[model samples]
Target chain A: MRARIVDKNDILKIVDILRKDHEVIAPFQGRGRDSFFDVVTDANRDQVKMHLHNPYYPPKRYVLPHIEKLFDIDQAKMDVKAAYVEPKRAIFGIRSCDVHGIYHLDRFYLGRDYKDPYYERLRRGLFLVNVVCTDKELDIDNGCFCMCANTGPASTEHFDLQLMDLGDVYMAVAGSPKGEALFADPIFKRGDDSHVQRRRSILNEVRKHFKLAVNWYSAAVRYITTGQVPEELWAQVGNRCLECGACTYLCPACTCFTVADRKVDGKVVERVRLWDSCALSGFTRMAGGHNPRRAVHDRRNRRFFRKLAHYFVQRELSMACVGCGRCIDVCHGDIGMPSVVEIIRRGCAGKENDSTIIKR
Target chain B: MTQPSSNDKNIYLPKVAILDRVQDEIQEVKTFFWHFENPADQEEFKKFRPGQFAQVSIFSQGEFPASLPPSPTEKETFFTVRTVGSVTSGLHQLKAGDKFAVRGPYGNGFPMEQYYGRNLVFVAGGIGLIPLRSCIIYALANRDRYKKIQVFYGSRSPRELMYTQNLREWEKIEGFEFYTTVDRGDADWKGNVGVVGSLFKKPDVKVPVENTTAFVCGPPIMFRFVIKDLKDMGFHDRDIVSTLERYMKCGVGKCGHCCIGMAYVCTDGPVFTYEQIKKLGEDI
Candidate 1:
């Protein structure tokens, strides 16, 4: 009915207690800087960084995986057989923006005349354990725009259990029945809202430290509806674009993908879904080698419009971006989100200047 | 919030279809009439429209979306293929009683209802005749509803022309004016020997543009030339409808392969009027 605190000394008791009812998956260093979810064993608390923000990929991998087999269709005989797959687990240390990313995906896929059985099955078998932001180690001076998008480290619903960091203990509140059942174990003891409020104030202080801001509420939609925004603008931003799809790869909400057909034993056709980005030159190639968006400038424009414009036409909301800084962090060209916006804005402001000069 | 359903995963699923009949039309082209071994789906397949196509798959040969060749109005169902790829080639090897997989009657078909009071002009090139075959049959089946029916068929050569028997049969139908031509003619050829676009030059061709609908399906180059001819003849862009063919993976909107600019060919159209297409930037 209330909340509890898992203290520094009780970390083992808490993970062991939580693992009783749920398959506890916590973030651990996989290889080098790459992070992955692993079973939370007692000796691995140092490896389990629960206070960290969203990892390399969103927790979406637990739900909508990159490659999943849909039902197999017999080509010779036009007969369809339904395929089903499901896995159950609990995730620890998910950030709020990543949670919202899953939420956006839900609205796009679930509860309709047609349902995504794979995503639905994966969603059904998981619990979300979110950690509120208290550690401000990642420098926010570079204008990360998550705050402007109204998604942040602070909880905005969707988590089953939310952990708020205090000086010596982690305050936990169960947001769902599953969370409630897990917290009812003796490993957790009832705590007060004062700790939550204190943590909340800390998160508020952390939010303001960010330097990035995308002022437009519906940048995706606006960009799409404002079609034909001159080729020069794209060429300007296009020059800076490294043509690498790192932004798409690290995005919490980016879901564009490709389907690859693999032959097993030269008899079976295995369709594998791999992540695809419109930013790539080969994204829309036809059989005889005709690419509609031939130029990188055109692709640059398309990538932005697809997120901000195209999907906006149908979904009303811009599916273009989720204000995640993954694109910023991963861009080798230094022509990531902040620069893209600035070039477009400056071009729109009649700068008549060329974007060819790469800035240091 | 709930996780998004992986409904998209279902699109790759194929359906089994047993081949009932195969008709070799031209040198390269053949028509396969197939039905579901599952009897209930056979009934649903019977209800497919004239222009909508099916994503047909031949075992171990890959899958491609082929136009439904038979008129929905007709009791028989089939698909016409111009054996160009591995899937179609595999399909070519199959005999009656063999089976394959099929998904759809996908894409926006020709607006049959809108053509009710209007004169219907059907323009097709080479194998593009396959999709138009359904519409031609439908218009002929219900010939009394429309004022005029004119079909202009074109091909690269005399031997490449498809539906020779049906083309002759279509001539016998009252109120139907059927004209065809070949870019290159054989010694025995008695018909007009020129590009199919030349057939539109015939003065008998009617263009009551205000109350007329034209269906165009062909190679992209032919489409452009024929459209310019239609526009020159004062046919309004809205009155000119064409079926587009692009690389389509999922017949549903999600797969993203058939996107032409912002338009998804699988969902928004495989059939779009010129009025709709002019705004979409680039060739459909």
Candidate 2:
């Protein structure tokens, strides 16, 4: 089926239609430069930022929330019940990189050997309305590297309806059957070849807006896999790391959690899963006090190795990093993925020059 | 051996088990015998191997991974716990008939099939002997399938030693050499006085370095020293096996807390060979 062109007013009409059945979530400006996903009610309809800045936090919380209650235990009856809830909802104005992030999370959570029933329940009921990035200032910014990650400016697949801006009009393409159903109404019309050309030009323009170029990701992979990157460089990076855990918490693909039990009363107990970070000292601690990765540098080394090592990467079936570069902004030590790659690149080059000198 | 979530029920939803019996193993350590409240669940839960642990839940407190000290071959399933922190101390306060939730027989247990025909050497220190006791009992139960078995145990003092009753029985049993030692003996103590590695020096204890699989579980310092001694006496890393303990939330691989490098300790192992341990690239 051909892509369709829709006006801003018509896009709002689709949101109104979706709101009738599903809880529609759209990006809205949240204090200062920060933007977040919020439910679209009639009062807040005009506040939705159609042309966007990528939200400070990715939409992963919708699927794998911060505090998920796994089960409840009744002490008196000796019974346990699963606390699972699945809500039908649709998210509008999601950027391309975040869509890729969701796809990555799906591959890890559902596509893996064991499908998380909770994540699956929420994911299956959800609808996505992805918007292509066209505004350099609002959509593309200094901290984005989705071009290098091969996941952005526009997504090739995995969306319900992909909305693209054509200056005054928008080109809407159906990426799934659910997306195609929106076209049954007259709000969408068949898009021409001229619309396709316009999207390509807009994408090309946003690619140039990226502040820092990241040509080292794949190269760093080889050095990381071969175990040739010197320990000295990692130690230096470790020294700089404050272990604030902002990086992993901000990174869209970082999915570590810890389960905790709380006494609801004398009769019942609740078990909750909270977001966990590997950078913390106690992440690998055992009961009677034995910890692997106790050293700050060892833990620091672990994070990079897990993300870039060939075996781990192969297991995840995709590089853990989608290179959204959100880590760059959250990191206090300035030891985010892009910076780590640059340090590794420098170390690899230095080692090569040292080898050349020794041979001579 | 890599079971990435094989359970049919919600993996985190635990079965309520009643604490049937409790015994003080030492000053700080206690062994509690528990049975599933649902008789069918008890039958199902009894199918775990040695070295696997269960997540014990005391309602008011949290859950902790306690080593199943009793082997599957044993009639009762028990956990030998040391009161190290809140959850463990909470378990210590719980009496017989008190209810708690338990799920798992988690982590890859000791590879019993691989050690079937080899000479077995078990070394443990302090309350670290808890998990090792499961293997010793299992190996002795299936005696014909294995060769010579030697157990070397150590503790800070005579008072701190664990599982004295089991040690007494093994000492009298045929085809088994059991040696005990205390780092610093008391007035009534009359045993070898030194670390666990020192036991290997006794005339009766001939720890065959070759053609033997050594299983060591202890405090980090003891583990390091014992590993070094084994290396000096010539035991390949692959031939050495040990159960690792890591801070775990979900016994399933989903929680990244137990992760070290690429392997999740909760899934890939709480049981691993020394060769695998080195490759993990962490400070175990």
lDDT of 2 at B133: 89
* Model 2 per-residue lDDT tens digits across residues A232-316: 8889989988988877777778888887878888788888888888888887776666676667887788888878888877787
Best by TM-score: 2
TM-score of chain A, all candidates: 0.82, 0.94
Residue-level error in angstroms, candidate 2, position A251:
1.9
For each of the candidates, the C-alpha root-mean-square deviation to the true structure, in angstroms, is 5.5, 3.5
Best by DockQ: 2
Candidate 1 residue A146 Cα shift, in angstroms, is 1.5
Q: What is the alpha-carbon RMSD of candidate 1 to the true structure?
A: 5.5
How many clashing pairs in candidate 2?
Answer: 2
**Considering only the true interface residues, what is the Cα RMSD of candidate 1 after superposition?**
3.7
lDDT of 2 by residue, B16-53 (tens): 78899999888878889888877877888899989898
Where is model 1 chain B poorest over a 10-residue stretch in terms of lDDT? B1-10
DockQ of each: 0.32, 0.55
